[model samples]
Target: MCRSSQTRRACGRNDVVSTWDSLRLFSPAQYSSLPGRLMPSRPGELYPNAAHVVDYLADYEKRYDLPVQRGQRVDSVDRDGPVLRVGTDSGPWTARAVISATGTWTRPFLPAVPGRRDYRGRQLHTVQYRRPSEFAGQRVVVVGGGNSGAQIAADLAHARIDLIWVTQRPPRYLADDIDGRALFDAATARRRALDEGRTDAGGVASLGDIVAVPPVRAARDAGLLASRPMFARLNTTGVEWADGTRAEADTVIWCTGFRPALAHFAALRLRGTRGHIATVGTRAVDEPRLHLLGYGDWTGPASATLIGVGRPAREAARDIADFIRH
Candidate 1:
């Protein structure tokens, strides 16, 4: 997601520097590609960095001749009789159907813990985190057990910070050999099994949450990857456990995750009580003319990832075309 107005403008124009900028750049240096996926890295480059991803996306856009409307921030999307009206900073446009592909990166979620406000130390979501050096010499508590949390904790450990990595449960590390390709295959198989009325064998989730990337593996070997149980509550100085043990910290980095960036759809009122828009495939059940993409499995299995999004995207496109043809 764009970190600033300047970056937003550059991203709108599909500028390589700003499209995936900070989020990708700030990822650990050892971050590698999801092997066997589309968008292979340049020759001899097995581990692609943020710059490579940016260049790949830019090249893809140019090759496909994608027409990107620059500098327009979509404010709202509403129904206008037979069509959908999209209100953006630039103006408004009407379409027979609207596909909302805006992802969740912009909406960082921090859980409400007791005494959160009273805690005087700094608090930031993963989106706001740039590098390990920023927290130098401070006691940092990294929360959440997801990939970002694991990765961030690993990053901080290497920096020699006083770090306490806490999770709701012990962090699950995938097998050393497992990677994105394996995860995708497992998910596909699980989906097929469920479709055939068989027992739903867990997919990627069965493998584990955190991928054993090089950095995480290194930290694990060094015994710095051990995680503590989540704290009971926050205090002015730090976090306290249910057993009343406390650890003073200078900052808490929340990798708790994010909600979909769906505020623009408020006018459509598509979301149910759970704050999710029900979907049959990617098409909204309440509003067939509306489609949501790259949110999560509710839309399509693994649809949130680059390799996985293509299947749902193609299905959405086909469905929309068929709807228009009739």
Candidate 2:
């Protein structure tokens, strides 16, 4: 339906550039277009814009003839005897097995701070950030220490905006040596260890660590990537520090991350703490008829990511197909 050049990814943070931080499975060819893959640069500057991934996905849909009905916002997923009925905004569809790939994009998490409502400055979540030019010449405060916060803060600083990067603690920047490939190798190793019944695989490098993309790299090169400790609360004009210090801002961008969008599965009674459904290799522990595709590490290591999603998706597909056969 969206033949327009401006789709969701184009409008959503289109100005923000990103590097593929890991090897996303399913579409290996699409992954080929990722930064440093085809578009190589020093320290991963040759990355694709967010538009590349969006377009690739669209093309993949057409190429595979995937029966994906866009614009059908699922309202609920309930069980009807042996089949599952997915209630949507448009209508209801019944399936033998349901694979919920409902990613975290719709649910942006903002930390609760006292007087958060009192701040008069423009407020937005990472979901709403498009470009830095809008905040040019304005004092901006970016919250959270993860990749989005780092990249966005870098964008604002590059625009010469009065920028304040605030994290709960200091942000961690990934080393220059660690590219997306290396992260994938680590994830693969972790997966292998898990399969071998080894619990001592130790900690693989966290994908949540910030990749040094061009903007972020430039920000670091210019000494602009520094983040202050999070402020205690929001006030009328700005944020107040825990130590009684305060800073004024024209806008606040919350990159605090997201929780899973699993409310649709509420009717199935499969939710766990923090909106997570416990899964054993993508199969819902309580409901084997359901498979969660890309809700993050609980489903599989790096499975929530672009490259990492492929492995779990492939596995879940096989399991679902086999289950349906039996």
Candidate 3:
């Protein structure tokens, strides 16, 4: 999405509003590809793995003739009156309107539990994790209750690793027939309930519920999907439960969440409560020129997911185009 406004401020050459055709955008995750999703049902429809996504993106870019300057690192986005001075590793690119669609891959949040830093076992976040084969024949504790946590724990379980899942509560597995779009609708309902200050949003299962991905389904069938209560702390050798039981683990894979990597926007001084830049829709409430996208529900409902991001991205794109045209 465009983060800059059309107002003048000693315009620079890289300004997207003036030269939207000059450069488009950038991201680090193989163009932000998700490899875990199931393949599309329609023939010739592909959006399953990272490779398929790259293929689709390549075709889209080719078809649209998008101006994508790869390898250019955005260092900072400093507000200069009506425009934004986007500082990159190469140099400054100025824009009357800039879109900050920077996704959350860069910032992996690890909860600050006692002894987490001092743990003797191999510690890695799901970010560093790939296949379960690397952790074969070892006692592994997969933390968190989200999709990654569920899938990775399932992976370990399938690989015959001594698997233990630690979560706040038992993980919920969604119906086998459920898909992301349906879940996203449920998420919308949940959000509305949250806004209305009603905790009882009955029937909408938590997005945190395991989506019954193939590996997870297999784990369920194998009866390996059981989860333990959150442990008290990490130990020198393993983790200690609140009830004082200690279990040995060769690896501790954190599936914790992440925060928005908006340190680049530090110059804007627009950050509000919970270290998030407050926004009305995608527009930053305090800084109208700035727009944030693909962060999470705070930026847009279900904005983090592939299916969810398109709406916000399209809307923000339209808004940016409109802002420039006006």
lDDT, each prediction: 0.76, 0.71, 0.69
User: Which regions of candidate 2 fall more than 4 Å away from where they truly are?
Assistant: 1-45, 194-208
Candidate 1 per-residue lDDT over residues 213-258, each given as its tens digit: 7777889889998999999899999999999999999999999988
Model 2 vs. true fold: TM: 0.84
Q: Mind giving the per-residue lDDT tens digits that candidate 3 earns over 23-68?
A: 1111222323333332233353221444444445555555566676
Best by lDDT: 1
Candidate 2 per-residue lDDT over residues 1-326, each given as its tens digit: 11111112221233333322221222223343422233222243245554545555555555556675544567788899998888876767888988877677767788888979999999999878877778777899999887778888877787788999998877777785555666666777787788789874543455446777666877888898888998999999999998999999899999999888777776778777877888899999999988887677778877765667777878888999899899
TM-score of 1: 0.89
Residue pairs of candidate 1 with colliding backbone atoms: none
Off by over 4 Å in 3: 1-47, 189-208
